[model samples]
Target: WSPYKLLTVFTFIFQTASKDGEVRLVGGQSSHEGRVEIYYGGQWGTVCDDNWDISDAKVVCRSLGYSDAVTVLLKAAYGAGSGPIMMDEVACTGNEASLMFCRSNGWRRNDCHHSEDAGVICKPNEDESGSEVEGTTHVLDRSMDFAESLKNLYETRQFCDFNISVKTNGKESETSIICTHRIILLLNVDANFMVKDGAENFTLTVDEECTPYVDDFIRYLYIKKISVTLKSSKCIHKLASMYGILELQEFCSQLFTQLLPEDLSFQNQLSLYSYALSTQDTMLADSCLQYLAWNCKAFAESEAWYQLTWDQLGNFLFRSDIVVPDEFFLLEALESWILKKGPNSPDLDKALIQMIRFPMMHPEQLFQLQFNFTLYKSHQDLFQMKTLEALEFHTVGFQNLNQYVDLSNIDYMPRIYTSPTWSYLLSGSSIYNQYNPYYRYDYQNFYSQLRSYSSSFHTPKHTSFLFQSDMIQWSFAYYESAQSCRNSGRYCYYDNYPVLLLSFESRPSSNYSIQYQNKALMICKDSYVSDIRDFKNNLVVLPSNDTSSYTFPCSSNFSYQYVVRPLYYSEFQNTQ
Candidate 1:
């Protein structure tokens, strides 16, 4: 019989049968899924779900006119079932025509309570226009016939807006999936049935019955938007992986076009590294990795660095890019990570030490690693070979590159910025600054005034500073002068371009924003460098290194502190 006809037959037997000789679903929202009860001895009784599994749930689903069982729920998913505990320890091969056709401990013989009653949510089959197709919709981990016709509606664009009410924090948010032409090329899932008869809009009212799927559905709508820019790095990564055109798929090219490795914050660089790995954006990933290697000492001590797994920690120690102040930093960080795991922790298996490049290490570093990792004579030759390879690389780079080690299941990482190397020298600017008729410096001079105001300060992460702490509707950045340029002296000159290192006790900001306190007025870059009045149409957001002290103007001693609005890290993710 057809799947639909069989489902109808089960529904018939479940709903009505005078002699009580068939199985039926009860206490559910629909006929095809719910509590499992059988008609036996002129009375309906429930089944106990002892050792129930997919094979058993499959039989239950197919017999009731479903494609297959999605899940096996215990603990009385449809509430306590009354009457005899008809079947126990049921086992099936998923090809059985009925529950009785499968092996079981037999009727009314079970060591189960009413709470252990077996239940199955089955797939609904559709046979529209007499030429139906057969396929299963996987939802909640089950193979079910679900919304095939509606999937067609989404594809055809022959529908109106549909409302889904999502409840959160005891409140409902009405979200809409609008029908439009641009989405025609997208949202293309196959189906024939539709909810609308003419043009009436459909409202999917979600309440207590389906509370679990509310948050998931809301996220689904946001993902469907395929916005050009997204705020969440997680979400943007999700869409890019799923759609291939959303975010990171082409981001490698984007990184090449407009971004340098130095543009991103430690957090953003970390995210971009993972993003690069996933999308095979090798150039970006390599650049980010190089930064971490170069600053091995600082990163090793960072809160984020300690979070790395043994594999990440080991790999960094073994890389050639880790040449900051020399490679001894690798041995120290690796030993630190291992000690944190405890001497007996399996994660510190001595075999992993082989991954470290011994030859590249200075003699002292080799002695250090041996003290930490080596003890067995059986692996002596292997360690010796690795040492030679490291020496070869140190002497003449990699004469022959080996395959990279594998590190799986890593979902996220942290990042940091490298020191600045300027394109021009700023020496000529000092003389110009002294004679420029913008404004005269106070007795504090440039250098002394800067020392009075701590260059480093801390602020909470905000998208925009509303002059208020919470509920910031509009976020922005403003510069406060803790120190003046008169004290900076020669340190202010970089590449002949008037550059200054403005250090405040600041966490790396997400983006750059500077609106004068006058509200919305900004000083453009190089606009009246020494004058206060030139802050009208020109506000310069100096290049950021995304560190405690970011790159800013140093030629003038204008007391400047930048107020920045929080931003989606991805939006400015090293925007090349």
Candidate 2:
């Protein structure tokens, strides 16, 4: 297998080199067909027609880097040539580089009139068919050149027969392709596969993103429209702005990434994703799918999600980050969403429906659900979801606050608020949407910074703070000041779920011997907060005199370090 593959590769390279050579034609309607000319000894001369045929034309076309020759002509088909009749009776097995290299009568030895100039027409090189000579390689550099190139191509089309029509499989997908000066065709045999078989002229069918608007494209590009519709003009601009070209695909992908939630929305994201994926814009499709995954929960509940195809919905179901407590919770959400689709809802995608971790459900819970709800045939996907969910639940799963920190307040839920602070940690204060917020807090890392001798200036007068460090980066609002919250409902934290409550992430301080002091209680010591001390003061820390690291008495999970002298030492020193 290896040997065969290597031989095939070597053959291809040989063929490519054989075809890519220099040759030219003169005095014809277009570059593809004319009286054949060969340059040798630094002088140009015409081929004699004594033995001109398609075989010789094949050699000529291949030399000029065309795919093949369509026909050979006699009697100066592109009009008679003058000066030197370079060669006569040329013979080629269709592999030689130049006519001069082929068996030919010596230069200027043709015994024929200039009328027998031996012209030939070559087959179009797929994308290269309509491009003018220099235009095929080096065209305009930018927008100004794009417009000018289109005009030049339109004018030259009559001479080259370069106009082409393209159609796609669906309705409203037909369009024309016009070669312009900027239409630099990357030379390859695969590019020719788009041409329909047995077609008299080039008929190409490409992906939907590239299908031109036949009328609009030709009218705007071929014939200059004096005034076009704004919509039409925009379409024209997009098409002519290097439309259907793969070169700018990455640029477009990056553009969409920056524009999202600003210039783009979920409504347009779907369309763009489809278009980009169809056009082979890989980065764009990947980015779009990732964005969808991040907002999977909200999107699933939104009207937009129901509008999506089954395949699209399946993408979300497979994501590990879909916001759900467990497979059972996720299944319930899916069922509810499906119910909203009404009794006449289309058939559920069986493949996706089966992905629910049904078997993994606790045996008792699964049996209860089975009695109450319908079960689909999800043998594999459902199993996969079960295993994945179970693995996730055991390892890195977070349990809500019920098991840990007690938020027993009836009127006030855990209102984690942030207040502006003047500190040397980081400059500028801002709320986080989590894209790239400047403020960061980690419980373990914050604990590491504290030591037995460490101390911060005490500032109880600074009032209640959510966090305290070298500076207070975030602090909760007092109950009386709750009305000032940007969104009271959002910060209410009323959805009664808790996760690792012992974890407190905060910054802000000037304290000598720090403790979990409740400033709210200090300011409003008379407020009616039930078991108020539990919500505030009883959470103070007592540091060990000799130990540098300490653990909270409530749970071993909580680690802390405090700066304090030994209790016995403090009393003895006081006595002395």
Candidate with best TM-score: 2
The superposed Cα distance between candidate 2 and the true structure at residue 426, in angstroms, equals 14
Each candidate structure's TM-score, on Cα atoms with residue i matched to residue i, is: 0.31, 0.32
Please report, in order, the local distance difference test score of every candidate based on alpha carbons: 0.43, 0.42
State the local distance difference test value for candidate 1.
0.43
**Global local distance difference test of model 2:** 0.42
Model 2 deviation from the true structure expressed as Cα RMSD, one decimal place: 29.1
RMSD (CA, Å), each prediction? 28.5, 29.1
Write candidate 1's Cα lDDT for 516-548 as tens digits: 121111122322111111111223222222111
Residue-level lDDT of model 2, residues 105-128, one tens digit each, is 344444455767798899977775
Candidate 2 lDDT trough over 10 residues, lowest sum: 523-532
Error of 2 at 221 (Å): 13
